[model samples]
Target: MSGLRVIPTRRRGQDLLYVCGTDGRNVAWYDREAARVHLFSEDLRQDVLDALGPFLAGAVTVGPPPVPTAAELVRLALHPDDDLAPNRPGEALLIALDRDPGPAHRLRTDPRRRELAAEQTVGEALDGLEGGGWRTLHSIPLPGGDRVHHLVIGPGGLFAMYALAARRQRVVVTDPLVTTGRREPWPLLRRVRSDAARASYALTAEVRPALVLVEPARLDVTGPPREVRVLTPADVPALARLGGVLKPADVEALYAVARDRRTWGKG
Candidate 1:
């Protein structure tokens, strides 16, 4: 995973934590004074959680839990259908769950849990920009049933941001195609396409799509894969800077339309 840099800045008289991903992406400008830590991931061990709270350059507040998936909920309910029989889709998970449910649940939800941590980390940074010429609407439910982790409007143009915690993995990006270290590519790319269409239609405008691959071991990006920008969490700060400072009125109008959950689907 890429590292983070906490650059200090003051916006509108608010002491802010301007955090950046390794790739110089604009992660968020957090309100150092107002952000209360809320640990959102169970996958993170207590020790890790304890250390993570200092990002605001202070104590970390164990925040609420992260958003979960259908599989997660099913597993949590111990639904019989969630069984992990060998040779099936989640055979290993099933077996592990059978042998011992605790470890298995942790393993299965680890990736998603990391995603939550990333979102929460970034979300706190974003709070400072909430009314300071930037606006964000997160966990937007789409007609396709998947959610957009963050839909942002600011001095920069519109953006559809996705967060994935695929650390220690390699991803090869080529236009119209992507090959990951594990070689599984469909789900990630497919979601990017769907998100682009949803955001575009909802705002009646083109929305740039970006993927924030958490801390990948290596990313060999030859070109924009399928017109989507593959980025690391560290690149968030720069990504935000790319907007070149759009007008406040435009930002407000975009936020108003984009905030309407229905606009996302109708478009």
Candidate 2:
């Protein structure tokens, strides 16, 4: 008789919290209750709900509702999923952040402030990493000292995709960051013929964009977008002078890059 076999395995649960923003394009994952809320637009919410409905078990609210008693609010916040017995896949309760139909200014007030602070902390963290010889590769503009040398690290052959996306979409990728040099080649980029297609592949799949930016040396871009580009990593003082003048659109654009690289199948 064959010997009994044993295998080591791990199950997936709420090891991470995924918060899809009100923007149809933004999806952020959190591991801790930091002082920020994940923002996702209504359009994307539908997609995320469909994808994650199987795991999420709560009433994920998008806007403030009628004033409830303190006790009620606590109950709702704690047992948000009670209304939907087993809040699993195909039974998710979603609310659009814009469902209230309020002024755009009001809509952005809270979220923008929160993101601004987060972005600041992110920038500081990236700077520290770079100082320690860590390369920061992002399609978004990093607010560091002048000579903004950002590296739009692609998944290998996707350099052309980013270049086209930036130019055609009028996406401002201010300065260039160097791609992390990879030892092994990615088969997907080698097989694909178009840059747009490559970008699409990267967007839906990549989970940690900020990490990609800071630690390119550690990643092995074996999935796709194999063709990497070294953008103009110069002119730092000017970008630094601008300070924290980030627009929501700019934030969205960064998401665009992220989405393009991590995308999988169509909606």
Candidate 3:
């Protein structure tokens, strides 16, 4: 009972258990002390566990799910924000990395966070991009089950960005791709093409994709793919300030499609 305490997840009335097993620490469904660990986002689960430990000691156990209660359990099962609304699938990815880390997922809690952090910084830079001029959506999912890091739209057309946090690491941008000194060349342009096509469908507008190689230090590009622009995190704000404009209808249409929770997947 000590390690398997009944607890409320971020959402109220949606209770799971904090578990300690020989294999590792996790959150799972409990029935008669049985554990069914629902795998979604490991980083999120760990954050929940870290935060839950203190909050649960004094917080209210339940307040019922949100309105349109029919979707309450569905929403909970998929993992929701504190207010019972859906969260980005990438968030769940970070959490899942915490639960069962493979070589790739293992770096999520650390280096990848810098990557995600760079995305966050760009968000701050784009703070003035909203309201009739430009709209951006983060962590967009493709039909093929891949997710785009950032989607931006304006009069200049659409842009989808895939970002990596290199943190001052040595990186070489070879036009259509990137090869780090410490890592293999990442074929980000391929993803850009695929995601741009997907965005064109989602937004009904042709999208140009960009590969953002974020590092705290130096970044340079040599004849990168014509369609995909390679740039550093610092260069984002200027790009964002391009002042492209979209028709009201086009704006609403793309925003609606990108903002839909159904497009985010279960995380």
Candidate 4:
């Protein structure tokens, strides 16, 4: 007996079957996307193949893993703490709330919870575009205690997006100001553009600005806000239809840089 077992795992949306020895050490892995069985040790090649025999489909190249791409190398070099790729939709807010949850029984709802819902709703929509060759980083911290709610990179190019919790409220957009229900108008669009500009400077790429309103009952716009695209969660998927701005490699490269916490420090 080979004393080897096949373990399945998923990484970056791809399935991988790892061949492990009795000691639980990975000797090889079968990559379905690449159609290759990568061997860590030439001596165990046959044993690893035998272990993965049942899982193997079609013809697959058998050899050492291919060389890592530039993006892969960058990702591999990142420290886990400094990698922002895994941040959840409302990561910073989640951390803040966890640190000081405040009164367990509140008289009124916490506004942060509303904002968290907006971000998570929008974040999930953006995450769904991954299969179309897009990447999203949530809650990217900028300098001076400010942050970009989400950064999207794909064939449509880069976008620094802000999430607004409008929930059942009517929204009115007048130039720089945004009014939600009866609340006083705020220059939210200005801030959105500024965040995108700062991100552009940091990444040395043109990043468009977007304001995403979550489940607003109605929306009124006096005129199209200059340099900012206002959208709803439903509009996010259409962005995947855009192309010609960046290739797959460029998207991966930009995503690699954007996912590093240090990249935003410059902004």
Top-lDDT candidate index: 4
Q: Which ten residues in a row have the lowest lDDT in candidate 4?
A: 65-74
lDDT of 1 by residue, 164-258 (tens): 66567787766545665776655566667667656764554446677767667888877556557777655666645555545666676566555
Residue-level lDDT of model 2, residues 185-218, one tens digit each, is 2322221223332232233222221111221223
Residue lDDT tens for model 3, 1-267:
134443433322444453332322333322222223332234345543454454344333221111223343344343233221233324535655578565664634665566557666655554446653677776665555677777777655568877766776777777557776578787766766667656654433356778777564666677647567776666766664464345545554555545665543332
Tens-place lDDT per residue, model 4, 75-109, is: 55688898999999999999999998889899988
Q: Which scores better on TM-score, 1 or 2?
A: 1
Which of the two, 2 or 4, has more TM-score? 4
- Order of all candidates by TM-score, from best down to worst? 4, 3, 1, 2
Query: Estimated TM-score per prediction?
Result: 0.54, 0.22, 0.56, 0.73
Better of 1 and 4 by lDDT: 4
The lDDT of each candidate is 0.55, 0.28, 0.54, 0.86
Please say which candidate is ahead in TM-score: 1 or 4.
4
Best by TM-score: 4
In candidate 1, position 142 carries an lDDT of: 66
Error of 2 at 194 (Å): 21
